[model samples]
Target: MDIPRSFRKTLLAHLPYAVNEDFTAADDLAALGLNSMGLVQLLTDLEETFGLELPDELITEETFATAGSLWATVSELVPAGQFSDA
Candidate 1:
């Protein structure tokens, strides 16, 4: 699935160092400066923005490893018919 624009905006906001880079879905977020604290904040932001609670099982390092992985997780949780480019 494609990453939602809102999701990208939220992800970019947490990645301070990556703002100027041409980051892609496969880019390593950690290398882009997404530390532990940033990850937590990102999680909270994503949850609140998407209006969905991430299940414990879904909270894994792999899930947040890259933008694509994170988007995959969010796409799975977003309510059907509610997803939009915005």
Candidate 2:
């Protein structure tokens, strides 16, 4: 599976805001209404879904400021070619 696409879908499913396909990678999640609790939930879901144990340092506002930024972090944690198309 495409990690970024999956992550984006998961995030949108949990978000209280109405994010559409028009949403870009540079869109600020906080500004888009993703509060702390939502962020925590997103993190938890991501960890469970991806079977990842994210380090504390990786959980930062800067790292999750945008979809692309968060995807970058995931890309770093999950090695390339590890994610499957299924």
State every prediction's TM-score relative to the real structure. 0.88, 0.80
lDDT of 2: 0.74
- Report the C-alpha displacement of residue 59, candidate 2, in angstroms: 1.0
Note the clash tally of each candidate.
0, 2
lDDT of each: 0.84, 0.74
Give per-residue CA lDDT, model 1, range 1-86, as digits (tens): 36666777888888888864357889888988899999999999988988999999999999999988988888889898656773
| Residue-level lDDT for 23 in candidate 2 | 58
TM-score of 2: 0.80
Query: Which digits, one per residue and each the tens of the lDDT, describe model 2 over residues 1-86?
Result: 23355666777866566456445778778877788888889899888887787899889989889877887787677756655542
TM-score top scorer: 1
| Candidate 2, poorest ten consecutive residues by summed lDDT | 1-10
lDDT of 2 at 25: 76
